[model samples]
Target: MSEDSPPGLDLARLRTHLDAERPGLVTGELRARVIEGGRSNLTYVVEDGTHRWVVRRPPLGHVLPTAHDMRREHTVISALGPTPVPVPATLLLCTDESVLGAPFYVMDHVEGTPYRQRDQLVPLGADRTRRIAESMVDTLAELHAVDHRAVGLAEFGRPDGFLERQLRRWGKQLDASRSRDLPGVDRLRERLAARLPPSPPPTVVHGDYRLDNLLVAGDDTITAVLDWEMSTVGDPLTDIALLIAYTEGEALGDDLSSVASAPGFPPVADLVARYTATSGRDTSAMGWYLGFAFFKLAVILEGIYYRFNQGKTVGEGFDRIGASVAPLVARGNAVLEED
Candidate 1:
């Protein structure tokens, strides 16, 4: 695993926090095994004898506002407990600043391998890969099916102007954090703004829905959909668009490697068809949504590049991310112009 943080756990701080959260459980020596993969947060699998827990806190270094909100992270998973969505049970949230210099939350450590790149899913046959991909869709469908009001998510995000706010919010992030100038960021933003999708009924939108962000069981099932930090109530198509973006038009196919190969997984057309059948939402704007997804990802990657320049992050192939942004903006532009 990538060493995303300093070697070994912060033994003193870990013990202190765990002591307050679970009395007497902090006794004896405690060792922390860091979990890698996230670019914006610190996840560790903490162990003390027979007890095991997962602690998620802010990134190793400074971060921007609206990024890495542990409270929001813990709240969404907690709210999702009664829902059909599979989520790790939230155990405790520590807002005290002194413990680790930032708020952190502990939840039951879930067991499953992360399904990120096409390489990870290669062991499973094409049919199994299709099943896994469909399970991811099904989980998302069920999440969208939940009653937001009944689940106490009425205040999760403002319903009105949901689409407008998202575009505006991410636009600001792009402007605030891009290391280098992307060729068509401004043009794509302008075009996307000019031709925004029609707002539909508000539903939970997993701001980031991709293969890597989810965990899969050996049976090719999505046991848990991790990373709820960016989740909010908004246009449901946004989530579908995200899936389209990651899968890059080959959503449910075989040869699941690099997200570029084609053949086995369901194609974007079919994936959208299945989702439409399950979600019962209008598919008229799906093309527009897919364009928006591509554009949004480009902007986010550019923002990471921006952060890298400020001397915040290093490595992980971010230096070359600027190359991906222009194409994504162009893709968005094409979608808008074609429609």
Candidate 2:
């Protein structure tokens, strides 16, 4: 192991375990570096000077209950591999904590770019950018159209009362990480609880869906849909609504990482229309879903803020994250009022 390996990953132990579990996988001395951009899970790019792979695990500390489940992420990706959904080929799921002090999994390294900011899309021009964004929406529709039962994911999640459980779960997460007062947060939660929209037939839900979560190839194709820590079988509309929130929300500010604001990226209404046309799902109750999406993002950012304050977060770009929480709460209330 190199002396400068990132936190929460011991290369020596990792290589030893890999050699024992899957012999001859590592050919040479193993080297690894942290892959940034993910806020909840810690991703690392490991290499043996011949082959490259990606590793995923829970954050360093202050992990909330039932959050960042490595087994769930691995299972979903593995299940969706045979489907049209693009996911890395899973190599191994390590549950033995003695190896890494936390459960982790490894998969083949995919080559693509996760465009975060609008400027990053500018170089691609409007036509290419539009094609990539539309492909993103289409990919999401394809995912919602998948038969969870056919993919052997019938027992993946409880869809009976998904919305109510999601609201309560995120509320509990906020309470667990409450370190500072947030205005309008209570009002937002109450409003959401008061007006629960009847969910359409449940489908696989990617709890966090956005452009940055997708890796795009040079041909404007979505190579893979990454980040499944919050994924499960739930209302499909929740997925699209969350995508809308990430695209249109003002909480993160203009300079923050939002490729949706780039030129030629479809607007919220256009994206919604495309999804409706493709998935044949009714979007009449999208207003309420959008409100809930903002609330969920606010709670997520607040949790990150708490972890950052405690010096538990491992990456950069977290300093301005705390300020985005109040704005997100405000946006949630505003969306509900407009609805």
Candidate 3:
């Protein structure tokens, strides 16, 4: 191991595994730096001076089973390799924990920018920003249009009761992550339960689809749709709803923390119209879907807050996360009422 390997990865053990698994993969000493913007998984950029690749693994400890499964992430991304959906080329998957204290996979690292904030997109100018945002929605439509069974992902998830299970699942997660009493969270959950929408035929769903999750090239094209930790073959509307909810959060100015409200980005309505027109799915019940999205995000933030309280999260930017959960709950309530 290098004398200064990052917290989540061990360079020495990684090098040994790479050498044995694929000869000549590493030409010299390996160095790594953790990539930010991902709250659930730890992403690292590894290099041997000349060659570079990206590595992904679960968080440090207290991981939810099924939530951060590296095998699942690797499998779905590999399945989509032949499709129109852009994904990094999967290189290796190391399941043996002895290699890096956890399972991880490495993929070809493509060069592009992940615009997490509006300031980053502002430099690209309004027209370019609009193109990137529109492209993001269109790419999501393309992903939702994929044939899951033909692509060998038919058993990825149960589509029959997907929304129902999702509602119940996030409620339990919220209860488990309770650092303080969230006033409107339960009401939002109950509202979602009272008005569950029947899902359209299932397709591959990117559980968290948004602008920042993609790598945009200088030409305003999305090079890859990263982060498949929450992906599955389920209700595709969940993807669309989540995408809109992100832009809504941006509009709320509550540190929903995405480039969804950037000056040049297309309106969320345009995104919805494009997806509905392309996918031909009924968005009449989108209010329900949007509510579910807000609930899901609120629960996700609460989980992060829980980790921050336990001192399990690494690095900066976590202190303000706990404060965002309540507003998300309120937003969820509003969207549910709109439904």
Which candidate leads in lDDT? 2
lDDT (10s digit) by residue, model 2, range 107-209: 9999899988888998998999889888989999999999999998999999998899999999999999999889889889988998988888878888898
In candidate 3, stretches whose alpha carbon ends up further than 4 angstroms from where it belongs are 251-255
Model 1: CA > 4 A from native:
1-9, 24-28, 249-257, 260-263, 314-320
- Ranked by lDDT from best down, the candidates are 2, 3, 1
Candidate 1's residue-wise lDDT over 105-132, tens digit each? Answer: 8898777777656665566768877877
lDDT per model vs. reference: 0.73, 0.89, 0.86
Question: Which of the numbered candidates is closest to the native, going by highest TM-score?
Answer: 2
Score residue 140 of candidate 3 by CA lDDT: 93
lDDT, candidate 3, 26-128, per-residue tens: 9988999988767778999999999999999988876764678899899999999999999999999989988888899999998888887888988888899
Model 1: weakest 10-residue lDDT segment is 249-258
How far off is residue 267 in model 3, in Å?
Answer: 1.6
Each prediction's number of clashing residue pairs: 12, 0, 1
